[model samples]
Target: MMSSPSPTTAQASSTAVAKRIARTARLALEKKFAVVTAQIDRELESAEDVVIDCFYNADSRTSQLNKDDEYVHLLKLRSRQPFSLVKSIVLKDGEYEGHVALIMKQAFPFAFMKLNMEIRKHVYEYLFESEEKVIRIKTKTGGQKLPYAPGYNTYNRAAILAVSSEVRLEALPVMYDRKFCFESTSILMHFLLQICDGRIYLTDLNVESYVGSTARTSFYLLANCKRLRRIFFKHISSNEQPKTAIKNFWNDAQPWLTAASAGQGDPTAALKLLVFDRTAFHFRVKDPNSKSTSVKAWQLADHLVFVKGLKDKLMDARKV
Candidate 1:
């Protein structure tokens, strides 16, 4: 007869089974996360009207009561991969009484689409397992009580999607390869312009922050955004010569800018104004859809005259 298995053998078998069970459970949670996120994306695409009404319309039913809340802000997904970014928002009561919840309309099943903290942890583990610093949990402090799940009192968290955490502008992790993907610039711009208070006074000039070593990158990125109204670029350090680099960058990108402007019917139309200084750069656009009065042909000529002439003037002054 076969000898009965030893206790050590039985223990080993049990350990292996436990590991498999844990692995399977983890995978199941990840799959659920994938399905929910995919469904959210599909709903977003089909429900453009709902998105606008719920998020943008301040006079909408949801905003009617919260109008007095001064700290109203939109939450946005910040990701190096363009498609992975989810467009979502979080609104809080200025007095800090209620839960910080995701902004959603009644039409969408916010409860079903929302993710539990456990699932968010799993998703981040799957996608950014190597980069743990990117995702963070907000600690309760200053009399702010965050929402929590059952059986928890101190640290409460609900199925709310929170993507509006503040991130250092230029010091993104190395995983985000900006030059390889131009949309990265768009994502960063949206973070600075749309998600934030709609403007950034850039004091950091790291190449990664600008997405490239030239001003052309900023121009191309801004060309795609319609909501950004104004931005100020100032030199934080003397080592970084922004004015000279920007002039060269603009000249290289002018052909593409001209073509884009012509398509829009006004050369200065895509952007309202671009003011250059040896120490700073200022930009303004009245409205995304608004067009400039100057004709396309004349706008290009005028820009060349202004930009090139300004560059020459600065250079000549330095010689004296």
Candidate 2:
């Protein structure tokens, strides 16, 4: 038989074992916390890089930001955090201050309306209108569509219009004044749909036409544009049943001409010009009565001449 251990010895052994277990748990917790902190720091750094890139290379940076996992995670984390906690962490005096300031400016824009009217107009023109820049509506690789200024190498200035309703009301006319060039009638219609009522201010448009329901519908929508002044149609096909095509063209244009005549009280509101590709003049249509007879498409121009109110509003694209 062995002697029983003392109570004091047994108590001391139990305390020692408890301390080892406690120490291991503490170390594991500390390691996990350190890893989490490091990951947060990395995400912050990545977010900072994205913000900076947005100002310098907007188009590419925007695309990258949309796909970045770490940035997305940071956004979700920030959304979950309490406002006080977020402010204390993000607004601490350090490398993040500048980025925070930029974000704040965007979030809370200055009172642009307080500026003088002329200054506001100038700023709007500078951002939205340029003689050298023709805003081109384009589709991206992911099938997302938006307008861009290829000549200026920048995205469309429409972002400013979303600042506030006041800004949009003041800036819309200036924005719609820019000449928009689209690849096809369908793209033009899509843009018109996106802009909604902004079409009322549109003055200049350039587009390639396709003979189909989409083109007819696009023209029908355009007829409602009360201030449209000029439209340049490119690559119209002359061989597509000239008589029927000419009839459809006149029908599509009739609404616009009627509107222009009705708005004669406002001289500036009338359609000033309609330009078409020279190819449209070569249309050959078979006479319905004579099976073998083909007629020249000059009838299209002739029909325009006979319209009651249109005086020298039509021209070949080359003349423009």
Candidate 3:
């Protein structure tokens, strides 16, 4: 008859089981993270901030709010890779409150940037903050002083040149030899719901944002949109690790290499604004013969410009 195992033997067996479980868990996590990173990279096929960080916080900014009650400014990543940086704005009672911009100078996108601001000590607080210190805004405390340092813009974030303008999406050149796979979301869920919910119309939505970095990637993706067709040069890069390297890589993508070559100095200037007309795009219900159609509205009418651009670039990408 086989003898019963000793207590030590039983303990050893349990430990072995635990080790196996841990190894399996690690493998599973590696696979999941790899999938997530890949999906993000594919989405941002043209973003300079190729690093990926979920920023899993409830608030985009740590803790700040302005008058407009816009507690959080959403930096929706149209592309999969993490953003090169994040530009945040704080408001109070529909008035200008404060701002911040996060950037990783040493490395590229694998780094994270969180620009948060609070309306405490509006003057000196602005004069000196960020590591690089790249802000110049007029404040109530005084003039010529950095009113909203570490912030995107003082008076209005929507006016920031990057976010406010119609710009071109540069093509990624420095791709890695080995590519990884990700199984996460390609397009941000928020923007998807915005277009699908009808809160923002599909035909009139703006592909660009007037905040941190330009929504050049959005325009690139939407360029191939159904209504207003477009084309772009898309590239894929390896999806791995701490993300700082990817961040840096994205900061230097070029458009000149691609035929669209939207000026060297202004990489995104060639956004090629199709100037979609709200009245022009007509929408109908599910039925082909249904007259249950509607025109666009002020905010809702601009969505078409956003999603359609994606459909366009996707269509004729090879030609680009």
* Top-TM-score candidate index: 2
C-alpha lDDT values of all predictions = 0.38, 0.62, 0.33
Local accuracy of candidate 2 as per-residue lDDT tens digits, 1-320: 99988999999999999999999999999998666655543232335323222112222233334454543222222332222222322455676563443242112336888999999999999887655667777544446565444565566667888878998999998889878888877788777877787989998889876655567667767767877778887866656444555555656565565455453654323444667765554456666776775635545555454332233332221134
Q: Estimate, for each residue in 1-320, the C-alpha lDDT of model 3 and write its tens digit.
A: 99999999999999999999999999999998766655433221323544443332233335457688866533324324333444444544444345333442233332111322233223223322333332222223444322222253334422212322221011011010011111111222233322332222123232211221323344333332333222222222222121332232233222211223223243233244233333322332344587454432323423444334433443344355
Candidate number of the best lDDT: 2
| Number of backbone-clashing residue pairs for each candidate, in the order shown | 5, 0, 61
Q: Which portions of model 1 show Cα errors greater than 4 Å?
A: 1-215, 236-246, 251-265, 270-278, 281-320
Candidate 1, run of 10 with poorest lDDT = 174-183
> How close is every model to the real structure, measured as TM-score?
0.23, 0.53, 0.19
Native-to-model Cα distance after best TM-score fit, residue 8 in candidate 2, in Å: 70
Residue range 163-274, candidate 1, lDDT tens digits: 3332222212211211111122333433334323222222211222233444454454444433333332322122223355445545544543443344444444423333
- When 1 and 2 are scored with lDDT, the better candidate is 2
Q: In model 2, what is the error at residue 148, expressed in angstroms?
A: 5.8
Stretch of 10 with least lDDT, candidate 2? 51-60
* TM-score winner between candidates 2 and 3: 2
lDDT of 2: 0.62
